[model samples]
Target: MFESIKRDLSFIQGLLEGDVNHQHHVEYRGLSRLVDVVDLLVESVEQLERRLSELEEYVETIDEDLNELELLCYDDDEEDDEWDHEIEVTCPECGEDVTIDEDDLDDENVELLCPKCHTVLDLEEIDEEDVETVISED
Candidate 1:
């Protein structure tokens, strides 16, 4: 549409320039001004179209990032589920009931501390038969 308008404007300009008798006429000057204004308007519209295209591309990139972030968040939730089987034991130092994730027990280097008294709890001292695996409701 813009190309067609530009072509028509170019034709008009060619005709105006060719007519030497109407070079100093008020109507010719007025038409010349109108053409200049229309040219500027067309350039402005083209610039706006380019900017809109760039904005669309930027939005698409943001959408992809959001999808990746959502997946990472979802995977984190699933990872949390793996440690749902908690081992509850009474801390011998403070007699406080200390809860531990089941996965942490597999790591021999992991030090278990009683939260109430900050006393180091021996993982080896806790009997396997006494260690209760509590399945959380949620």
Candidate 2:
């Protein structure tokens, strides 16, 4: 479409230049100015089209990266299923209820902190009989 318009404009410009008798006429000058304006508009549209194509390519790359990150972050496994079980224990320092992941309980050296008060909670100090298992309905 742009090529056709450019060809037609070129033909009109050739005709205007060939007709030397009407070079100084008002209508000839008007047509000449109109052609220049249309030429500028066509060039602007071509530039905009190029920029839009570049933006589309950039967006596509970002979308692919996001898909890769989602797969890495949200992939489901049996190991992750074990983490679903939680243990509820009260913080001895502040008596605040603290929820700990079951996976963390397996590591005897893991230290817990109370959210309400910054006190170190020793898992070994809390007896297994006193700790309650929290089961999620989900």
Candidate 3:
């Protein structure tokens, strides 16, 4: 497309330069300048198109790298599943909800400290209905 446009502009430039015409006057100088401006604009547009193509390819490479990194870091099935479990217990003193990892509760009678109020909580005595379910995320 640039080639065809450049060819037509070249033809117009030749005509304006008085190579194929006898009217070599100052009144036709504006036509010559207009063709010069059009030629520069075409070249600038072609360069812009090339730059856009390069940027698109770079973005695709970055996206692929991110996906590969995620797969490599989270390849273990057990570890990924562990992150999906979470336990939510409310603090009796402050009434604030505290989230704890399921892995941290190794036994039935485990003691956990509340982060908000620094109160010790007994996980064994808490009823299941009082404990809220909180999903863990990576």
**Model 1, C-alpha of 138: deviation from truth (Å):** 4.1
Judge candidate 1 at residue 128 and give its lDDT. 72
TM-score to true structure, per model: 0.56, 0.65, 0.56
Worst 10 residues of 3 by lDDT: 18-27
Alpha-carbon shift of residue 121 in model 3 (angstroms): 3.3
| Cα lDDT tens digits for candidate 2, 1-138 | 889989998999999999999999999999999999999999899889999999999999999999998887777554475457889988877789898887897798888999999799888788876588997643
lDDT of 3 by residue, 66-100 (tens): 99988887777757776577889888889878887
With a 3 Å backbone cut-off (N, CA, C), the pairs that clash in candidate 2 are none
Task: Using TM-score as the measure, name the better of candidate 1 and candidate 2.
Answer: 2
Best candidate (score: TM-score): 2
A best-first ranking of the candidates according to their TM-score comes to: 2, 3, 1
- The segments of candidate 2 whose C-alpha lies over 4 angstroms from its true place after superposition are 76-83, 88-128, 134-137
User: Which digits, one per residue and each the tens of the lDDT, describe model 1 over residues 8-57?
Assistant: 88998888889999889999999988988988898899889999999999
Model 1: per-residue Cα lDDT at residue 46: 82
Q: How many backbone clashes does candidate 1 have?
A: 0
lDDT, candidates in the order shown: 0.87, 0.87, 0.82
